[model samples]
Target chain A: MNDTNYTPSVAYLGPEASFTHIAAAELFGHKGLTPRPTIPDCIEAVTEGHVAYAVVPLENALEGSVPLTIDYLFHGGELFITAEISTPIGQHLMVNKAQKDFTDQLESIQSHPHALAQCHKFLQYRYRKIPLIQTTSTAAAAKYISEQPALHIAAIGNQLAAETYGLHIVEENIHDFHFNHTRFVVLSLRKEILDHKNHAASKKTTLMVKLPEDDKAGMLHQILSVFSWRRLNLSKIESRPLKTGLGHYFFIIDVNESEDHPMMKGAMEELAALGCTARSFGSYYVYETDPSSE
Target chain B: MNDTNYTPSVAYLGPEASFTHIAAAELFGHKGLTPRPTIPDCIEAVTEGHVAYAVVPLENALEGSVPLTIDYLFHGGELFITAEISTPIGQHLMVNKAQKDFTDQLESIQSHPHALAQCHKFLQYRYRKIPLIQTTSTAAAAKYISEQPALHIAAIGNQLAAETYGLHIVEENIHDFHFNHTRFVVLSLRKEILDHKNHAASKKTTLMVKLPEDDKAGMLHQILSVFSWRRLNLSKIESRPLKTGLGHYFFIIDVNESEDHPMMKGAMEELAALGCTARSFGSYYVYETDPSSE
Candidate 1:
């Protein structure tokens, strides 16, 4: 009876109807899609062979890096980033269908703090005195509001959340900033899991470089110089705690080049020789998903 | 009636006993201390001439940069960092004095999300099934627990929070990492606010640099090269979003040099000519506070 081979199993950070779910559904078409409660759980599903791949939010255009995802990728068991899904995040002010007309009676506005913060201006102008409640996730907040009908509570989440939880969207694009997008990465146990469509807009190679412990001064500068002199254009560079101690950090550099490129390889080798532990996270395609399609 | 002119006025992010308050008291003592609800409020207190100085957290060892403080420094207003205070962060598990002996009855565990996350291991091992709640701050949680006695609620915060709120420390140093430190900055409208103690370990000059929008490639490397070739030691380098759009960033670099130093001045001039808009945040001394004294 355990013979579901036609569809590839995929996991995403979710409680269902989360942005991650939207991203996973956009990529995998909702077949064999499982929702894990946390980023680690999503990664674990892939590592344990429970799912062929996992999709987790790596960064938000507004919030910057998702530290949990970065930390897990750095310390957790081996997993490769196969693809990046960039989805335009549209935060919606939603309420239970029964209480949609009674929004003025809203005593509380509930959402993940990030979502609440993203739509802070709108909330401040519209419901100034409403108490804000923080939930584990936007989807979780939506689910809670749906379960407790006519409670005069509103949740700020995505369109998918409103649809999934049977809530009515009172306002769309309620985020303070319009250029909001969340980058979700597809993680796999194998090095490369190419998309069948392969209609990627761009390619990037991400590297984790830990500087030499003793060589204190200009070590980071030297590492960057190697990449610079080689003419490798860096799209992003972030430093996460090494977790060993304070002031110890490992740089995550996203180079706009493929992993197999000569300049990228040269930079990695030069960085290694400089007593820096440089490792390739992966060379992956970035797919900008059109929110309209979903 | 208001003739108390002996103490200098200072503001901090607080309900009275938050970590920012501790840092403020450690630097300025208790006299003329004002507690502001948020980071922006604390900064506004300084900028609006409500206080001589405002103490705010800038970065944490485990968590990295405090985005609010960074953002305010970049865009909020013109405030100079007068001094840097490095405090040892000790997260203690506390609860109402009435429920000190009945930790097993705890139905909920609460703290700021960062504090809660820091004590994740301890919470998992001991209060595995306890529902975790997020408050605005650890001190706020402690304050809430104090007001609602015997509610089977526990809070994770510093020692000061426990004492201030009349709670008992059930577990001390519950944070998983031992070497945790939070760097707090003293912000003032004036360029300098020297401590009477005249004891500082080192001096650092922080510069905010924004690359020319069009000159994309190798711009960051060139900026680093300016400091690297000059042999100026860098303690910290962080990139905050310009907020203009995605992928646009402005860097904050801390150099181990005085602002007046010849080489440092030369580097700043070179950066200016390189088509980068560079501004001096401040050149200030760093103070390592003794937790034992507190």
Candidate 2:
């Protein structure tokens, strides 16, 4: 029997112990979080009314953007971003407790491709000969290592994953860069929730703008001038393929203004007048999760 | 014993039959193409003088930019883009030849994440219940299916991979989109080759520009104006994190002009005056591989 009376359920990209899991726990606590296998499944759960919200990683400091997440939001389905959570990523080299001398006998390492790549320097310098296995997620890697109980095999994951899978940390802060962080966004099908949650002072509005198909000089510059002339800060800009053909792209820009801001609306109007179509994906406040809490 | 005098060696991302392998063969045939395990290895092989050139995917029409390749060229090592090759990606559903009628008992499908994602619609529609296994490369997936023949196992990869690994094509053109293509670039250490090979009329110059640390309104607009005022055509523009902190990024722009072009040099000089730094990654010719030849 399904119990929906207690708390609202949230779906996150997971097998439990993923970075998205930590992000979901950070925002909504650990009680009503459901671990979904893929990004689409997590998002679809919200759209299909199976969950109240879905938390998925949007971007990483090291890896520019999660392509699947960006693609899905830009073109796949109709879901609005309600809020964002930033988590400090700390990748650890973890192994089974029985494998005490992991460095001496470590035959192979496993992790998601991004995690493996973040810690590439350490692996190359210390264990060049060891093979690296790729998994769907870092949590999956930790789960696999815990279940297999193989000697000389380890995984690169976060502290939450290590604890969830009953693995010991072989090395801490294994990622190459110290400022590693990932930003996860909360998505929901209901527009009322997004509209009601825009009271926070610190907000950002995201827009997907497709320029005219014709090759016009200074067209992209003109689009940026709409925001710059208003003196509104532009935080991020990324180009995604329009998928119509080669060399065709639509730009996704994040402006430091809420949807309710008059300037933001005016800019969108001006962009439209210049033969560009803009789709606003709602505005949301960003909350940074404290590393000390973890 | 190695034969160095016979042919110049080239490294590609490989375990024998990767798309990069196809790109390498497209450029240099199959004889001197050495298969390296990872992108870094392939790039490093050229930088370390072990090979003459390294072929790696830069971007896919559907997948946007290849983060690892972009990051490495932007921040990792000293290498120049000498040439660019465009390859048409054709994903095929392959199975072991001996295992006929695999669809009836299809238990699992395997491929590189990108390949799998590109064919998500087909997989979800036809084999909804089958488990999808992630492999290092699509070529590796085909090879695995060939070596360890299973009744219900299939792989998604290119036609060359099916031929290389001796697998039978169960279905051709399995990808969801028909115009799927990947752009591969040749990375080399010598600047002379890049300069001498720029005679082709169709060339593109790439520049990495870092904005000022202090946030200023209209600064990005000013930078774009430099390119726009000169009537220069930008083929592509992407922002990559500088890894210093969140919201800090450096832009990589591809201009339709050679590095030696007078207007391009003027644009770079003006960008410098605006408290920004620009690094040129050289101009290279683009060659499209004819699908009919394959």
User: On a 0 to 100 scale, what is the lDDT of residue B53 in model 1?
Assistant: 89
Per-residue C-alpha lDDT of model 1 across residues B91-156, encoded as one tens digit per residue: 899989999889888989888656766676688689878888867568778999999884988999
Runs in model 1 deviating more than 4 A are A1-25, A28-57, A60-65, A95-113, A120-155, A168-170, A194-199, B1-17, B30-56, B60-65, B98-113, B124-137, B140-154, B188-190, B194-199
Taken over the whole model, the C-alpha lDDT of each candidate is: 0.78, 0.78
Scanning candidate 1 chain B in windows of ten residues, the lowest lDDT window is B60-69
Off by over 4 Å in 2: A1-6, A61-65, A148-150, A192-201, B1-6, B61-65, B192-200, B292-294
Provide interface RMSD per model, one decimal.
Answer: 4.1, 3.4
Chain A only: give the TM-score of model 1. 0.91
DockQ of each: 0.32, 0.43
Query: Candidate 2 on B101-160: residue-level lDDT in tens?
Result: 656688899986667766777887898899988675687788888887756799998888
**Cα error, candidate 1, residue B70 (Å):** 3.3
**Residue clash pairs of candidate 1:** none
Using lDDT, give the best candidate's number. Answer: 1
